[model samples]
Target: MMKFIGEAMNETMKRNFSECPPFFTPFGDTHKCISLFTPIKVSWFEARMFCESMTGNLAILDDINTYIQLLKYIEEKVCNCVNSKINKQCEDNERKLMPRFTGDAETCLSILEENFYYFSDEWCTVKLSPLCMTNKI
Candidate 1:
């Protein structure tokens, strides 16, 4: 059942990408396009792969402004479920130094619901929805 769901997600995403252009929003000094693959959760690595397949990568909130804008965007465009955690990109050293990090070797960054939707270090193997982004569009 999980494999079927995953396959269905990939097919849906591919069709969506081919039919509709991604909406780009202002991020710092450039425009960024973000896509949240929800209703299906996967590990950090899987999330990254999905984004890569779309010619993008996991979303990276580098500054407060970008973070705020993303939050607003998600609130308005995506579902309002507060229990959802979204995967994002993070550096190895950065994840390790986070206050809540457990010193896990395969930790990654995610927008944690328990952390008030803030960035938190979590095991890379943990399943979560992905927030993909691209600056090229």
Candidate 2:
């Protein structure tokens, strides 16, 4: 995994290209920068903490384009593990990684049901990797 160096919140800044990971793909026309953490699994709180540690936020994918692109990227990454010595294990990890958290919760105002746009809050403590975002597009 390539570590990108920079503080991105409101805007995407100009940084040294050499430090940027090639896998960090820009989603659609937004300023959001996303990277998957398939190798690490943590609870929702931990996931958020992890992203914050990197000066980012757990990708609360509210944009259709961004969400779609992320899924596609993940699919490609998982598929590429076919030749790995632990191919089955890798594929299993990918399955549990999905239905990722989106920073939403079940509140008194409303109850969120499972759907393409949102996932079950029960996954909050399920110890899984999350997509981190530097900026919300």
For every model shown, what is its TM-score relative to the native structure?
A: 0.61, 0.58
Task: Summing lDDT over every window of 10 consecutive residues in candidate 1, give the lowest-scoring window.
Answer: 91-100
When summed lDDT is taken over every stretch of 10 residues in candidate 2, the lowest stretch is 106-115
**Model 1 residue 74 lDDT score:** 63
Candidate No. with top lDDT: 1
TM-score of 1: 0.61
RMSD of every prediction: 9.0, 7.6
- Residue 124 local lDDT, model 1: 79
lDDT of 2 at 81: 62
Q: List residue ranges in candidate 2 displaced over 4 A.
A: 1-23, 83-89, 98-118
TM-score of 2: 0.58
lDDT of 2 at 25: 46
Model 2, residue 94: C-alpha shift (Å) = 5.8
Q: How accurate is candidate 2 locally (lDDT)?
A: 0.52
